[model samples]
Target chain A: MEGETIVKERRILVAVDESEESMYALSWCLNDLLSLHTNTNTTVLLLYVKPPPPAYSSLDATEYIFAGDAIASMEKYSRDLAHSVMSRAEEVYRDFHPRVKVEKKVGSGDAKEVICVAVEKLGADILVMGSHDYGFFKRALLGSVSDYCTKHVKCPLVVVKRPKNV
Target chain B: MEGETIVKERRILVAVDESEESMYALSWCLNDLLSLHTNTNTTVLLLYVKPPPPAYSSLDATEYIFAGDAIASMEKYSRDLAHSVMSRAEEVYRDFHPRVKVEKKVGSGDAKEVICVAVEKLGADILVMGSHDYGFFKRALLGSVSDYCTKHVKCPLVVVKRPKNV
Candidate 1:
């Protein structure tokens, strides 16, 4: 305790997705973590990762050709999805603690890789995420983003599990 | 801020094991989380879950029979392992912040189930655990305990990932 200094402002980066579990994790962070530090400067960064667009293959060019307008609409849809998720997260944060500073960030890449890189780039003190609660068989089929992030992220990570009753 | 009551004492249950990841998690909790609340009542519960002993079967017991002394010594070893983990956690807490109230708990059962039950019974505000950082194939072959707890636990959870350089 002699030389140790307490951090006044804690940078908390929360990864958000379009799932109830993610929303629940955001709510918990706002209510339980941020609310407690009302007097301190706690910056909460809301991050949403969009999957990288599908790659164009030479053989697929003949089979599945995308129209110009279709590509534009698809890009627009991805942007809109990112905005919507951030807006919802902001709404929840405002409802819980309006005065707290929050920033929205959207990254493009694989979810796990993007999250880890963002945490490092942002210099976040802690990274909070939501568990999708996949079953054994389902997890085997579809990999877990949180699991990957937990191992790869440079900062401390928190993976929140939404209670069933909640 | 009007009429809002801040929780003074937050009970944080940290699940520790005989892994470097768990020790790193304990260190992070002390430096990042608990250090911020030195003036307040912050209770950190260090929990270690030992896998339950193998069930004995009569048919195969003829070839794989364990002596009475060996069984007693194995039980003793498990108990000692639990104690050693908790002691190490306590030492880390003491080294970082001695003022924080720290409690050690050991449970015998599946790691995931024990952690969830301990969080509920202890009325913990949050449960912090460490990830083993298994790769895709490794995790697929042997399931992750932290991943399981993240899905099953009722309270807020933090899965701390040790930095590569640290």
Candidate 2:
């Protein structure tokens, strides 16, 4: 960052839960980064966490809420979720920041862990993601992330809020 | 925390450094909260930690250095710094957030701690502040205060880039 334009060179990471809220956030992040006329490269990861396969039992209250050793079924679900999320993400990006370059990744893992791993692996300087749900927002805040990075990492982090539109 | 129409009810703790950059942050925070139209009562704490008076130095390079404290003079300088900071802070609030009920406290302590302590005692749900030097867009935030709040606190934080006007 020695005398270089800070906004011009940006590497952004957006975590996608395939929710309309997440897509909206990605849209804002992409457009805002490009608006700065910055060199922007975005890698969006559509992440899904698999709750441990529910104990298969007839007496289970929500017995059907189980994803058994159903590898084939899981793969199909993953592909479908990825397809929908990417389609929405791409559409939003095209509408807001068509010129910005983007790469996509889809995986199943803990949302926070997946994000932390991607940030490190990509050497991303900015992590642009959605405001978390009330439960998770407590720990996962745009504010908290920026604070954490500022204290520990020598990079910049931008946390974008979701627009009202779906 | 019950059913309510108040928007942006997140408690915002704004730290003022008495710098133009800080004032911009001050305005942005007020406007942002006001827009939410929440039961937003902003407590603006004007913090100014006076540098200890320079010891009568005969040595070279002493001009640029912070000479050790003149214990006797610390009280006078501290009092003066407090008055100057609070006056400026009031003017800033009157100009920007006239509707916001304001409060002032001067701590002759570290900037970050004073801010963190205020937030804890007041149950601030948000921290608003400004960053120091950056590039063309003075708001290209890469600062210690904003970063510190982001990492250590749980509330949502909004850091306004110092308005470029100044």
- For all candidates, the clash counts are 0, 4
Task: List, residue by residue over B1-166, the lDDT tens digit for candidate 1.
Answer: 7897665688999889999889988888877776544455688888998879866566455445555556678899999998888877777887655577788888998888888888899999888888787778998887888767767777777878777787
Give the alpha-carbon lDDT of every model.
0.80, 0.54
Segments of candidate 2 deviating more than 4 angstroms: A1-166, B1-10, B38-69, B95-98, B134-143
User: Whose lDDT is greatest here?
Assistant: 1
What C-alpha lDDT, on a 0 to 100 scale, does residue B34 get in candidate 2? Answer: 39
- lDDT of model 1 at position A39: 50
Interface RMSD of the candidates, in order? 2.6, 10.5
Weakest ten-residue segment in model 1 chain A by summed lDDT: A56-65
Clashing pairs in 1: none
